[model samples]
Target: MNRKEFLAKLGMGAAFALTATCLGSCSSDNAGETGDVDFTLDLDAAANAELLQEGGFVISNKVVVAKNSDGEFVAATVVCSHEDLEQIVFQNNIWRCTAHLAEFNQQGEGLNANGSNGLAIYQTELSGNMLRVFS
Candidate 1:
């Protein structure tokens, strides 16, 4: 059938319902929800061995913890402020959302239009081989 005939047979309500379902599935239930986050990681552990290297990062408890180029630990919520997607990654000393490419600085300041809402930042403390990340 032609496009119009096909659409007419499908019905607008059905089309809208399908569209709504697709949109809903693309959203996150944890949107805008950065829960109370206070955790610790052992740098000596193999799971967190990346933190020992400069410019390495890990995602834990929905938080992106990274060791910047300065050999310092920095952290931010993995949830992107733009689309509320858990796709934040640490790269080149910047927090970027892989979903929409939103960028934020180490201090959680938004650096682009998609990231203007800013990200949630946490404090980090390193004592011995333990790294503490807290909101």
Candidate 2:
């Protein structure tokens, strides 16, 4: 699909369309130093309950780990495409940047309004009681 159509399908309005120049810098060259995920989260850890609870999330190591409204686990790089801030907040199944109000859905689709870019979503896997997030 064309860029415009792809953006539209993600709920990104015309204003948020990504130009060729901007698209080139949307994400980092390296998502992980190694092929493996950096950490293994304990699902039973009390400290992680809030993040694992529905509609809750936590930002650390430039990544956001959240439990969306559906109680499904989701993860994404927290760096804002607009200003490269790690200040991302998750609410109502959407991730928003505090610096520029850039918004993206759980599936990592950038929304309209601030002309910001989408975040890099990661794969979340549940293995026994541990949750692993990877690029």
The numbered model that scores best in lDDT is 1
Error (Å) of candidate 1 at residue 80 is 0.4
Q: Per-residue CA lDDT of candidate 1, range 63-108, in tens? A: 9999999999999998887777789999988999887677889988
lDDT of each residue in 80-121, candidate 2, tens digit only = 666576667787789787755678877767685442355677
lDDT of 2: 0.69
- Model 1: how far residue 71 lies from native, Å: 0.6
Task: Name the TM-score of candidate 2.
Answer: 0.68
lDDT of candidate 1 vs native? 0.83
Write down the TM-score for model 1: 0.76
| C-alpha root-mean-square deviation, each candidate | 8.1, 9.5
